[model samples]
Target chain A: MDVGPERNSLLAYARNWLVGLRSGELGVLPIIGGLLLTAVVFQSLNDNYLTPGNLVNLVSQGAAISTIAMGLVLVLLIGEIDLSVGYVSGVAAVILAQMLLPDGSDLPTGFALLAAVAAGMSIGALHGLLITKLKMPSFVVTLAGLLAWNGVVLMIIGSQGSIIIQDRAVVSLSGSYLTPDVAWAFFGILMVAYSISLVLARRNRMSRNLAVEPAALLLLRIVGLALVAGTVVSVANLSRGIPFVVVLITVLYVVLNYVLTNTRFGVWVYSIGGSIEAARRAGINTDRVRIYVFMIASSMAAIGGIILASRLRSVDSNVGGGSLLLYSIAAAVIGGTSLFGGRGSARSAILGALVIASIDNGLGLLGLGSGQKFTITGLVLLAAVAVDSLSRYGRIQAGRS
Target chain B: MTDAPLLELRGVSKNFGAVQALKDVDMTINPGEIVALVGDNGSGKSTLVKSVAGIHQVSSGAILLNGEPFAIRSPRDSADLGIQVVYQDLALADNLDVVENMFLGREQTNKLGKLDHNGMECRALEVLDQLAVTTIRSVRQPVASLSGGQRQSVAVSKAVMWSAKIVLLDEPTAALGVEQTRHVLDLVLRLGQQGLGVVLISHNLHDVFEVADRIVALRLGQKVAELDRRTATQTEVVEAITFGRVSSVPGQSGATTS
Candidate 1:
């Protein structure tokens, strides 16, 4: 297919996106807009908000919630919520801490972490079975799970104020940073891989007689992505370089995004979310998909718990308590994943996490209390939901006529 | 039309506890033929179609595909047997685009198990083009963005894409406007022309007259009359639906004929 001169321009692409937005296909526009606005406001209030060191800290601190939110995205895509995720993460952390205690079990750090993740996954599967096979509502099942898992955490942490992690490797999972050279190499590899994939996708489209994006536009996107990667790497290197947790989150984001966008399972998730009866009529194994999604959600929560423990160098009764679940859910929704399901990506979790972390960090810089931070976060989440509902309404109106 | 029937239902009966939705009903659909099942609101049209589509199991019946007994216990079983149902709702996911909805359950994947988006898009375009569906602006557009006729076209194309030999359409044009209804009726005729046996359950006698080669009328959970469209008049089909039998008097109203 010949690309017309007018259509080949970046301006044309932008206009197309605008047209889609006007028709109520909101995509990632709201999140991007919110992120930019927040950055401007926060940077104006506190110059430290935009500093390389502070930005690096924001990325590291956002890693746990961001990781957990990715799992929530999957669950949300299936039109389900895992209310127990917060407590599930707590249970995992408690187990990890107990296993790592100097006077406790002598399991290796890797084995202990694996055991914690496994426990979380098992709990998730149990929830899935109950919801799918027993025909129980996910909300009720997970709500019960929330209370039961919290009780287990209390039982495990009885009489102990906190368990300090002594394993050096476990501590480094979140506390360590990559060298500047390694960070630069990572950025270079990402750029190369991204470019190659773009070219290959274009080729595939051409071979299939499908319309391919103009070469100029494709190049423009590649360059744009590279610029973003370069800026992030440069900013991190200006400090102590990228934190290991940030790298971990980035890898998780990439993998989850690929799975959600490019795989058959991902399609099933969206289909089931869109309409369960439709999915069943299409001959999809809805029960299996729901089960796997719950498992993924809880396993991700377990990963978040491990990161939290590593960051604090200790696990306590409050490891995964105190609004962690709310924050993670808010991040997913605020990043653009529809709470109603079938309309989100792993990128939403990352973007939303960044927004939430920025708010918390900026408020901390201003010496504001947690109360103010909670109020602002709640407002932002409400605003995001409002946007989602309005856009959905608009789309429905458009479809009807 | 082929001599051998593609699908046959004998003594199909379904009971929802105290209510008998279908009782001792029989139907035979042939290849390259369009059979219209006309009925009133409570005449078991939906129940019969659902039974054939495996959404509901018949309490007692023998379903034959190619002269052999077939058991449809699930939608998957029906799909595997080349039976597809384009329900009134169309069953298209509003969030997914045309290609995604077309291949929802049976997605094509590459060697690495990733969805082969390019391949699916190519096949989707081919199928849509074959059906001459041009109203869709872009194959990537979500179903929610399409008109009623376009959504129906996608759903039908999805059924065709699965190589279905028998297609059951329940009120394919019920909620459609005049133009869209015409489009769907044309597609239904084309499906018949392509040698797929089509069972279209509709209330519109005009649509049934336009596409159906044979008309099956049902009333009170029983198949009342089977008329060849080439020989039977609209009045006769209506009589069968209302009174479960056609009046013998020519050019006489049912009241006078009785």
Candidate 2:
């Protein structure tokens, strides 16, 4: 009943959101709500849970899994799952460790990193080819990849126990932090970039006579982003500043979000995810898109593995084994990336990773065992999936009516 | 009718190992004309449409565009020649918004390789407006939220974009309700009036008679009759489909109504 002038107000925004809720368009609200609720509960259980130092540590701990989760979002978008991401990361970590071995080839750290990433990408491409060309399901192919890549890691390590990373740059990836000054400067740059993008997008929309968001709403969003960035930078700077791995993860998130939201390739990816037949009919190269997404997923997983290795200062047979794969997938799904695909974002990885990390951090502070952690995480994963399915069902019912 | 046909299929035949799906089919689609392709079950009407749309390579015969013979080896090739097909399923990504779906594969990008969202939205609006589609509330709304008729309109508009000169719609109104079917039939007529060669493949004689300028009937993998709407009767077209141009009662050609 209330339309027109009130449309530009925050009340209108809330009203629209309510309307969206009724229509079953539950965007990121659940994840954000879960995140806030978890943070409160954890902080209450452990007085140090929300401390700046612990929060910073939680971010660094989450970086590796979050990076892999971002990649998982891509694969999941196409209604496919990559089961071998853990082992793929393991293969890269092994390669990195071998390259930096004391009496070994002594390759440059940069080249070694590239080589590790390349290996991960190559494996991804192989998986993609098998899935697309041979018409095999991604689940089976990646499952086989999981086992095979694990074997490759074992073959490379060869009972050497664990290789300590002596390379300074490699060790610094997760172990070191940015200085306060550098962190502040980075935040400044981020704000400027965000502002410029917003302005440009508005201008572009206006020029083409496409509907632009109300200027007030636009400003509100920009200011909101700035505030969040400022708070994060300030909080991290309170201690040793943001860790390099945290920065790395943030950069990955930004770049990936840009690619997914701003590019033609991104459109094609979502289209294929939404309906492969529709994408094909629209003349998209679905095969190429699938192959490329797999490559990206594996490469990011490898990068995550590298970060994990850096955090531990070593690469061992157990580097990517255990519940790492499950955690990464849970992060993506819990962050709101739909298992049915075509409905997620790169930011989902970050939010989901933070949630998982909070649980781990809280449990660790409480002296809980790995069994408890797994159980709680598995429960959380199930709840997230249930929410996803319920929302989808609601959407379908609403559409039909 | 005076200009060269936009698309022409000559002696087209397609076989599936032991089964011949299409046999020596000849058809022409001219600009500014709506040709209704009427067929019964297993009538090879789909095969004929697919052959022209390059979904199936004809086992024999040639396809011409603007009176020039061209090889249509794949769907891409057909699309490249400005021939677009709106399949029975509609082939629309239900999750994507109207503009996104409209520009899915052929998305425009800026210099930085970012999707030109504004440009795409503008173009999509233009296309929809040209087709006089006003039922859709927002271009940003996902296709899943659309009514059946609205979805059909979006599919038609998408095909008409990218400078498409010919559009093949396979059973566009098959899944629609009465009102929705009427809306789709109106859209089909508008498409023909816009000077694009329109092919309406349908089972409903009412729809076929309403919008089609000419009627093409297929029966048992062959074109049984091609009749001009101005001169042909529905009974004649029905008879052609059921009996395949051969009157069982030899002397009752003009008088057989039952």
Clashing pairs in 1: none
lDDT digits (tens) for residues B2-30 of candidate 2? 36688888988898886777777889988
Clashing pairs in 2: none
TM-score of chain B of 1: 0.92
Cα shift from native, residue A352, model 2 (Å): 0.4
For residue A360, give model 1's deviation from the true position in Å: 0.4
Query: Residue A307 of model 2: what lDDT?
Result: 92
Worst 10 residues of 1 chain A by lDDT: A1-10
How far residue B13's Cα lies from its native spot in candidate 2, in Å, is: 3.5
Measured against the true structure, the TM-scores of the candidates, in listed sequence, are: 0.94, 0.94
Query: For residues A1-401, could you state the per-residue lDDT of candidate 2 as single tens digits?
Result: 34465465656777878887977778788888887988898888889888899989999889989999999999999999999999999999999999988886767899999999999999999999999999999999999999999999999999898899999999988889989998888888888888899998898788877876767677788899889888988998897789988778878989999999989888888888889999988778899999999999999999998998999999998878888899999999999899998989999999999889988888898789999999998999999999889888888888921
TM-score of 1: 0.94
For residue B47, give model 1's deviation from the true position in Å: 2.4
DockQ, structure candidate 1: 0.61
